[model samples]
Target: MYLKDVPRTDPNIDPATLLQLARDVLETEAEAIRQLAPRLGEPFVQACRLLLACRGRVVVLGMGKSGHVGGKIAATLASTGTPAFFVHPGEAGHGDLGMITPQDVVLALSNSGETSEILLILPMIRRLGVSLIAVTGDPASTLARESDVNLDASVEREACPLGLAPTASTTATLALGDALAVALLHTRGFSRDDFSRSHPGGKLGRRLLLHVADVMVKGERMPTVGHAASLAEALLEITRKGLGMTAVVDADGRAVGVFTDGDLRRVLEKVDNVRTVGIAEVMTQGGVRIGPDLLAAEAAQLMERRRINALLVEDSDGRLVGALNMHTLLDAGVI
Candidate 1:
């Protein structure tokens, strides 16, 4: 390639300086995390054991940026089968401490290991006989020294060029908190069902989590027609129920074929007098359907892939006990 075709570097930029700065920042942060991995000795295991055994919630406390990380950690703990909540250190001194019980375990965070608000509540926490676990950079600092168990979250320096912003330190603290939550989760044998219980509003909770029985249509709302009925009768049933389709059933109330709006359109194109034809003659044999026991999410996938608007819900004997449409899934928020 010609020199003119090559991209020109900025005149003022020094590539070596930029690369060195990036390396230093990553090295410092990596060193902090590397230190934490081995520190998962008996103390860390004991901490997980304690939290797992606790009958009450885990109370987290921190100041400023640490507080934000603490909130996220608490949420992670709660969603992973551990009951926990973040208590602002400043607010804890002003009556929010009432939320904590003697049965609870307190996880306090402070980079300097000397947050006044956290220290202010130490005496009260002690009086309540609550277990105190501290996460701080200094092991010998007041908060760390006074805590029942201190987790060392020290870092060499901040990733910031000024060495003032809490970049690498906060990152290490958050990673440590995540490690603790996950370790406790595994120890407790927390399952996906448990997680879904804590997060019923999320998408994952709706998929593998929510049961089919919770969102299925039942009783008179279902559109159904006898298998021997005329095509006109099935169409009237579909129109009356407003489900765009009707379940064709046998004499024993079992599902046979399904007559949908699409079937009607195709049949109408072939024969102008579809009203006189028997529904079984024009209905789709072995149409796509679902059991009431199946997940609503699975039903939605089936409908989408098959390009169908409704499904005949059948029992083990192919009995048409219920019916569902795309609208049903939409209304239930299963889609």
Candidate 2:
């Protein structure tokens, strides 16, 4: 597609000017985020403590652009160990307020703290005896006045030339929300394992964590054959298990060689009678293997680097205990 086809910018605008406009906006908002660091005082600490001590879910509410930021903050909190959800101010009055209980905390966001929808729900929230927290540019607004705690998401000015669009203010509010979530995360001593549990489908959950034992084939599903078995016997085990390979084990049940479908084709070229050949004679010795305790993602990396599929899962004693293949990785969402 041609650059002129893009809808956001004027077709005749200079590319450098467009880039500079975006850069300026980002720089101004970045400065706004930086300024929020020193402003974290007693109120911020108390907000973190309240969120940490919350027994019920965090119900975030706002209108317009503040609602968008509130939704994002709720998602971040929910994914990072804090149970939370967004409650649109308009919807809360239309029966969605049933989702909130007295044990829950309501975090309301409004730049002027006078957003009609959010202000309208203040009475219902108070009547439910729910704890109230407000994020606003104005501390004197009704939302802040009625809140149990107030978070100042105020900014000096917006990056927009019109000074109407939410730019610096939204950035500051987002940064403050992140600070609260992170502080609560630290105070709760949330670990990477806990984070992974919450994000099992994400890339971060796959890389630094998730173990092979959590995804590998085991017991009767694993393909194995005695070291003295014929190539045909090994092939039968591979076909029966459908892992594309069979682990050959010694008399002591230790892995000695692995016979894959690739090995079968290669051996067929060299052996006059493949059916009579011993698997040990045709198999690759000391093939790439992994421990069941290893990460499934690490196994994928190893297989990719070595240009192979299927790994014999060995115990610490080198005894074959399990087996896994590319299909297993795919099934476990490790691919």
Best by lDDT: 2
| Reference-based lDDT, residue 245, model 1 | 85
Per residue, candidate 2 scores C-alpha lDDT tens digits across 1-335 of 22223456556877776787777788888888887778768888778878888899999998889889999999999988899999888988899989999889888889999999988878888899888889889889888899988988788778887688998998899888888888888888888778888876766777547688888788898888998898888888988989899888888878888888888788888888768889988888988889988888889999999999888888787767788888888877788
Query: For candidate 2, which ten residues in a row score worst on lDDT?
Result: 1-10
Against the true structure, whose TM-score is highest? 1
User: For model 1, what is the C-alpha lDDT against the true structure?
Assistant: 0.84
Q: How well is each residue in 285-311 modelled by candidate 1, as lDDT tens digits? A: 967868878888888889899888888
Show pairs that collide, candidate 1.
none
For model 2, what is the alpha-carbon lDDT of residue 24?
79
Q: Over the full model, what C-alpha lDDT does candidate 2 score relative to the true structure? A: 0.85
